[model samples]
Target: MNKQNKHLPNFTQAISQLIALPSISSSQASWDQSNQAVINLLSAWFETLGFTITIQAVPGVKGKYNMLAKLGSGHGGLLLAGHSDTVPFDENRWLSDPLQINHKDDKLFGLGTCDMKGFFAFILQACQQLDIALLKKPLYVLATADEETTMAGARFFADSDMIKPDVAVIGEPTNLVPVIMHKGHMSHKISIKGQAGHSSKPANGINAIEIMHQVISELFKLREKLNLSYQNEAFDVQTPTMNLGAIHGGDNANRICGHCELDIDMRSLPGMKDQELVSWLSKALQPIAEKYPARLTITELDPSSPSFQQTPESELVLTAEKFSGHSCCAVNYATEAPFIQQLGCQTIVMGPGSIDQAHQPNEYLADSEIIKTEQLLAQLIQHYCF
Candidate 1:
């Protein structure tokens, strides 16, 4: 197929345009911005390159889209996947416009420049050098939505009819290292309901605040059990962990505390399941609920992202480690790789720039890192497709 029938943005223009377009994906409604513009920009570029472009609308998320651009067709191929959206930025804290590409100290600073709309630009640049005719298997450029928030785009794509490649790479800033395993994220709110009464009449009503202490104690116990049961030395944090994020209860000191709510955050290891943990929690709190005649309920804040692990021996992981010259390791953060892995493709998270730059004020991808990424991706393409 003929490539670049029409003009396309060079690397600089591509990065600038992607950054200028606001595609902030946040759980807060006010901070959230549609990723449609980013997808459309990518779609047009892929179309110019003679790629078969298909924009899949994420089912319940209005104005959100997943762009899948195919360069060739076959049973197996290489997939360069990344999220189009970035985390909400603190504009006041930034030295320059967060939505504009600013260069300083040999770095390109902007939202999504590192964590990772810029990834697609490098991928596209690499593809420009690779002839489509030389590809025996498909080379797909995929951009998904809401990775900073819910990962809805990745979750939807996991079940979609898109081609399942034999190997996949998620461009989530890992400083050019190959990450084969990462922790999963899950959060919940536990609400305890009880009747209110005067402080003097302690027997008249159940004190939710008092009982919540017991609940918290039980949670601490559960956390210890979880920590002891699951441990992977590969991760910086060697065990599955839980945190008591927030809590709220009754009104004043004079009134007996009637209602209490606790929000929790749990990071699961590869072998652990959030559903099973929640079930255990309910069972553990059952006695307390019965003893105090308090109604205890547990509800999820958002869908859990299951932990992902690609064995070091897997071809994808080995190839990534070889190309990047970094040993396969684990990251502390969660990513879209787990969802992509569910499709049966051996996935590795390897991309340009350091993760410390992500979600921080004045985020950036260094010039050296960008060039290194382009060269590395070109080599990967040659090895996998040529």
Candidate 2:
């Protein structure tokens, strides 16, 4: 079971190599980088382990890629999946290089160490212990791109239906707990255009900020409606919520405000349709748009991440709970599970590291999690693929 004996990199080495490759996914152009390097590294390692490597260029995305490494072949098996990209990190906030794996305080400190290029490293180590020839069913390791931003990689791969497994496990830093449910996310931008004029002649120009005030008022009412309409006791936030994340308006105190923009984020509970929510949002703002004529516009910021929920009694959930010794729970964060589940596989989010550490400066995974997660992955492979 020793990786060194098989001539493959050990756990620390694997994670270190992954950490060294900066595959950051951000909506901002300056922060985003290609995930092809990480994908290539994973393909090389898994290829060494006798898995067939399929490196797919995520359609329409210039530099993103998804790696699907499969061992053996069959209709049903285990799929260990996670995203290849990490969120943007701030170097000044970290005590050590965020791109290098620093082993300190019994933890592996680095960007993406736990959320979750480290998950791929764990998979590689676990596969090193297994005999691929004995696998009765296929074993798939999926590395996707843009999970931190639009989740376009997962959406493309899942929609293609290239492969299907009986179960899918997304390693999304859930602290090794079986996460059966989580909310979805969608962002919207509302822009208002108004004529500019001298501040003394307020009537000569349409005030975009003043119009935005009415829009905000209506948005509050919509939030109240959502709170009253949806409730899930399983989540800490029992109802769907919306936040006005950003607002920008005109610059000068001497001039009338000519334009304004508002960015909003909505998190929906399971069973709430994304389009339906958009429809409700449009309905709420229709009056303002009508009153303002061509001055108001509402647009979706990016692809929506639909909420995900797996049944409590499902086999995958039960198996995960049994193996991890924790009951299935819910999280507020959105992951790629919903799209993967679209392929008709039983899916759950259970992985090493705490979500609390993800995306934070000096993010890390406890060294103890290495063995524990490797063991758990090995057990799942034995049960599902052997």
Candidate 3:
């Protein structure tokens, strides 16, 4: 709606191009088969825009590629980072085809249109309009894989000797606002093993299910303790919390269960160390270990995505706030910003879609939000790179 962005062409074609490719990262088989299709398309688009592109393959996932493209020749430029992967969607739950971009009124609906693919489209559009002759620093665009599942691509980028920018922007649907801080989620599965016997005789069997209940009770108490310990005024909840996401054990009613497993989710504040949280959980479960010879095994499904907090006065924060015509705020959902910040670059999460639309059926990005994102990105390019 801004006057500055009026001349730019509609981004619907680009969004359609992206939504046609199903890049669901959670399904390994589907991701492996279709990831290259999206990568090849993006690589060609970037190459046409005069960017030198490289497709980096992550280990363990064949055909999944992380594409890095750079424009201009100088260093310390801005990096527009987004994930090419999306969360898996059930086809039966959608009223319309999830893979096709459908426009209804002012919103464009599709599978990845809101969760991320729309943001990638805007980045591509911005790249096509950039003038290398007027740029002061090189611009880097990184499209990573597997952000919905393990964030393996970001972890790989963190360890590699790739392009290190002075500041990084994670294009994760923030509704055009800058998100500086959020909670980190750490998931662990605890497995317990015990003796199995006939249910008729109570003393003869060590019930794994009963032992798991004891462990879960202790975890609940630990959650309350955490609620009392870490509190922040900036966040709405003001404290870290824990949840028992899942519990599984026992075959049938006839026998004592030999194995039981519990899945625990811990959300931490910005200052809490992940290892420290694990250590605290270990200590809490220590008392029950000797009761039933219960074996305690903890395996983290996804490593803690640490919380993000940057000083309000930082250049990146200030620049983003000014360009977007909004103030900085904290979000409850985590982004790839914290991981990117570990690379010694200031990071901010900002983009077109709203968090309300993410991970929901018939998810969409508003046309107005897309236009606003384009204008803000144009201002950012002029101020930082030009």
For model 2, the stretches where C-alpha displacement exceeds 4 angstroms are 1-6
Q: What is the full ranking by TM-score, best candidate first?
A: 2, 1, 3
lDDT of 3 at 247: 88
Please give the lDDT score for candidate 2: 0.93
For model 3, the stretches where C-alpha displacement exceeds 4 angstroms are: 1-10, 27-34
- Cα lDDT tens digits, model 3, 75-134, are 788888888878878778887899999899888999889789888788766765666678
CA RMSD for every model? 1.9, 1.0, 3.0
TM per candidate comes to 0.95, 0.98, 0.94
User: What does the lDDT read for residue 378 in candidate 1?
Assistant: 87
The lDDT of model 3 is 0.81
lDDT of 1 at 137: 81
TM-score of 3: 0.94
Clashes (N, CA, C under 3 Å) per candidate:
0, 0, 0
Best by TM-score: 2
lDDT tens digits by residue: candidate 1, 72-102 = 8777788899999998877899999999999
